[model samples]
Target: MTNLLQTERLIIRSWIPERDAEQAFVIYNDPEVTHFLGKSSRVTSIESQRQRLIEGIERMHQRNNGTGSWAIVEKESTTIVGTIILKQLPDKDGLPTQDYEVGWHLRRASWGKGYATEAGQVMLNYGFSVLNLPVIYAVVKPENHASIRVTQRLGMKPIGRTNKYYGIELLLFQLDAPVKIEESSS
Candidate 1:
């Protein structure tokens, strides 16, 4: 399968839920992991996880613009470490907005290993270089310190809290396209 993006130690690609569900279950089924995310992000059963993955696959195809969910696999062991996403923000009414957002979720064991930051950086490149997006946003719970640190590592600037998206208040971070410096011929 083609990779959406890759870092030095990870491959970001399509989610094969059937193959990834058990590991994914270990992540999404954990209350500790799902605390910052809303209730709908939880997977109560293998069947529900399958349903979510099916929906995610469909969403990946529908976007056709490198915007959607993807599985993050570690290169060393070929294990699914987590999920990374570049999706349009939805308004409070669930209507898709032009604003694109980047996010990630890593398993507990994978935390503190920098997978989220690495995957996020590559997706930001894909969004800026391939998709030509001028800016990308990330919505995080104010209490999600680890994710906030990741956003900071990605050079995303905090734009303050917003209630315009997700029907819940969130701290908004924005990353603008890097300015290209043209070299002058001597």
Candidate 2:
């Protein structure tokens, strides 16, 4: 229910089951959308999708560390185009890992626009500014060029490939917060 950030054209808001479950189902189940999203196939049940939303909500509330997914909505249409996630990768035991991640999944209809780049900047800013995280990571499937482009536009550095984190091979990109330079009058 919390509105996390707002861009010129998109509103990145929290994942609320009562408000976002149905659309979340649509986004998660679309094959084209899920094509690079790992071994998971199109989710078949709205209930299951609702559960995922519930879990995301719980996770967002669990830590004041600014880790979770938010719904990306277009301001004019007020449509849920996709989601942007900023969270730490979980360890094998499902606990938070050292590497924090920033990623996005947009509707097929929403592809090719700058929405991902715009929304991603907001999330990255939140990670660095609000969360005070020194670095944030983005792990993408090797074949997912669109997302790669998005991360690049956000000024993230492509570190290397890694299978250790997400249980699958991914091209890991990282971005450190811009250092603040205080002004001093001579």
Candidate 3:
């Protein structure tokens, strides 16, 4: 597993079994953070959540060749603050899909500090450059102004609304190929 990926203030990396349970409790147990995610209450069982995190890490390794929902760590303290995921959606005709999905969550303590936007931009760069994906997508609830703003800040434009995997109404935003500069011949 990759040890670290960095933004200006954060480090995105693989889940450490020791640190993840507490981090999971912090994020999953918060009602405000999980509001649009379809869960009604905070998950109380740390062991179960820890197991789930391990499973997710394993599954991500199997799926993406060692890239997936990385534990977003604070650079100064090296704490697991949240997670950032970049994954491909299933394809239509038995072929792999090029349009990837990006998502993130942070502990309440980390909110309102632009960490999400910073980490998201780093993930987007990895997606387009390392993964060579042509486009990336994000789905957010219409009322999730913070998430929508993050998407907008990344220069992702709204494509449409769709029923997400959790059966919630979500606004789809997409970022295509990066803009190219044209050279003028005098």
Give per-residue lDDT, candidate 2, residue 67: 82
**Model 2 spans with C-alpha error above 4 angstroms:** none
Lowest lDDT sum, 10 consecutive residues, model 2, at: 35-44
Candidate ordering by TM-score (highest first): 1, 2, 3
Listed per candidate, the RMSD to the true structure in angstroms reads 1.6, 1.6, 3.7
Q: Which consecutive 10 residues in model 1 have the weakest lDDT in total?
A: 59-68
Q: All candidates' lDDT scores?
A: 0.91, 0.87, 0.80
User: What is candidate 3's lDDT per residue for 113-155, written digit by digit as tens?
Assistant: 8999999999998887777777889988899898999999999
Position 119, candidate 3: lDDT: 91
lDDT for position 56 in model 2: 72
So what's the TM-score on candidate 1? 0.94
lDDT: the better of candidates 1 and 3 = 1
lDDT of 1 by residue, 77-121 (tens): 998889998989999999899999999999888999999999999
Model 3: clashing residue pairs?
Answer: none
Which predicted model would earn the best TM-score?
1
